[model samples]
Target: MTSADARDAGDAEAFPTVQLDLPVPTNVRVRTAEFVKSSVEISQCPKEGPPEFAVIGRSNVGKSSLINMLTGRKALAQVSKEPGKTQCINHFIINDSWYLVDMPGYGYAKRSKDQRREFDAFTKAYFKQRGTLAMVLLLVDGSIPPQPADLDYAAWLASAGVPFSIVFTKADKKKKGGPRALSNVAAFKRALLEARGFPLVPPSVVTSAATGDGKSELLAFVASLRGMWEAAKKRR
Candidate 1:
């Protein structure tokens, strides 16, 4: 076990597990969701308007599963067995308030060089030009160790000055009462710290679509950011 694992084990032993039922606020609850549009290029996306939260990750990181789980709707975002199925910027309006943007996944080996370049251009433009983007939820597979693509993307986001948070998905796959996921998360954090040479790493959350874990937390976070976004808009 790594030092991070040792620390995690100690912390787990020190703390007692508690379940709290907290009421979700009105803004956070997904009363209604509808598919808005799909855009192959960033220029084709909706004009600067509502605050947008983007969901992105490497291919097959369970992004669609997490999105559907958070919204409490089945089949909201199409889940496909095939990797790199999402080829466009798919938008879904939540409660007719904010936009949930699903971006194309990166680092698919089967994609041709030209296809990868096209996607790279699309994603880069979206990230660079999307002025109304509030935050990006970068999903990572929690069952495995830190991936180079994930780490590199995190660094790129930081350098681009894009606001994002890490969402570790597939937590349910980890062994019950085991620290594999936590250890992996810790290792990722350490890697980030080493790369950035700063103790401050992007905020991260663990999630499990199968058990609906972290759904409320994720919604609550979005709600908080939405409140700030609305307030900022009003001020402007």
Candidate 2:
């Protein structure tokens, strides 16, 4: 057993497990709306009734591939061989129950400073201000150790008190029992603990868009939110 395994065993009951009960691809509604590149455009997010769950990450982190895995629909979102393909806040309404928001990735290359700032401005506004937003799934590349930028972003989210979870993508890239891959993920976990302390952050699930790892668990998390949405609607 690894160090993290021991640690997790010690608190197995403490960590919440995402319920994996929802059927895959029962009914998925995927679509792309306007690409909001500026702050003003983000303000026009649909003021609809369904709660929103936004997926975001740094550039080239496989956000689209992961989305496709979640919906059981290949090519549901634009999967690009190139980076920065998604530059807007894309929304997908699922079973008319929830809205899946795909926000523009931060920190992509080949962009001017002004363009990056615009992206950041729009993302910040969306996360901080979107009324129907229920949670943000912050995708992190698990093939490599967590970077300083990832830690910084997580810290920022915690400081802002935004509800978010860490998703380690590309698990299939790592070979089983490979020392290098294990070390990288361990380092990432250490960095996360150092950056934000242990309990403040949500438990992370390792995933691979290629092998469909963690797909059911992720959907179960979304399904568990059904109660929360019902309560919110009652409040309204």
Candidate 3:
């Protein structure tokens, strides 16, 4: 296995694997998805242009697959079964109008601990500095209960004034138990509210890359905010 494979980590056994349970819509189809460039710092990012919506998660959260599934571009973002292959801020132009930013997966990466820390340093700067970032898709593994890292990241986003939505990935995988993903999702909400005292439990959707679940809901969310970031430019 590659270093990426070896480094990919996931929390095992949270609840029953969630089923294909979320309602799906058909509108807001992606007309085109094209990878533009990758950047190490916010300075390297594309000029303050189309609104950018980012996707971020733990290394093994099925983030690449979820992005591919969401855009209906089977190969849009590089898919790695291992964790930490993506080490840059990847920009994908969506419909030539907006950008779908695929951030390096957090919590795990193939890089050395110091390198991972360095990665986080720059990305955090990007989040704080990028004026065109419209939203962040906080991809989470739906099969597990609340993870401390996930909760903390969500809290950080809120504290930083970043608009984000939790997009639960892997809704199709199921293990033997009572309620599947729904239990984990609910537990996550409770933990965020109770443990983090996060007052506003942000919008969330259950999704499965395997079954293309929650694709339209996510796309609809993205569509709803495509050009809204233009206001960010004027404030800068």
Candidate 4:
């Protein structure tokens, strides 16, 4: 059977529930500021005491929109009509205590083979090498059925041993009880089924940049991870 077919038939019980309290990303508590992008500095992302939550997803998957939603700002990550606009890692200091990293999206574009290759190399390096990345929120398009490329990338992350979770974007665009959302999440599970040594897999959260869904759950998750890291550093 094809991998996707097998996945579509797999049991849901095998996937454990990740506890999360969904919260809206509101402007009242969101004090966001965008910082400059420096690939060199990105290498040292975790050097500081604050924990970093990095967001990565496919090109034009409303990544910038999500960031703006989370920060309660109109245009924090620079929304653009073109794909592959975010060529570098963008950092935002939040509440002067933590950071939100805006990573370049993967898959699809009209770029030449060389540019695509360069992007692949750069993004792979960032995920494999970034030090202070406490949590990586990989955004998924909840408005459509699962794409093969998304599954492949999820498996890649599993194999690479990177910590990450699924964040479904643009849920407002999806019809309630839609097949698209189910397919997208099912695809994610299938990819993760092959992951080794990645115990305690994180939970997937649904969000809408327009409605600000899942904002609280995401922040709480990040805050929890930050605490764990802090405790570990203290022990060292």
Reference-based lDDT, residue 209, model 3: 91
Steric clashes per prediction: 0, 0, 3, 2
State every prediction's TM-score relative to the real structure.
0.86, 0.80, 0.82, 0.78
lDDT top scorer: 1
Q: CA lDDT of each candidate?
A: 0.80, 0.71, 0.76, 0.70
How do the residues 1-236 of candidate 4 rate in per-residue lDDT, one tens digit apiece? 75533554463446754554433333225565666454533455445556678788898888888888887888778888798877777778887767788877787568777877777788778777767667778888876766677766766777788877888887677434454344555545644554433343457777888788877766666666666776676897
Candidate 3 regions with alpha-carbon error over 4 angstroms? 1-27, 175-182, 227-236
Tens digit per residue, CA lDDT, model 2, 70-170: 87777767888788888878877666567677777888878888999998888877788887778888999877766777787888887887878788889
Question: Which residue ranges in model 1 land beyond 4 Å of their true spot?
Answer: 1-26, 175-182
Whichever of 1 and 3 has more lDDT, that candidate is: 1
Worst 10 residues of 4 by lDDT: 20-29
Q: By summed lDDT, which 10 consecutive residues of candidate 2 come out lowest? A: 30-39
Instruction: lDDT for model 2, please.
Output: 0.71
Lowest-scoring 10 consecutive residues by lDDT in candidate 3? 3-12
Error of 2 at 160 (Å): 1.2
For residues 148-196, write the lDDT of model 1, one tens digit per residue: 9999888888889888888888877753335444566666676777765
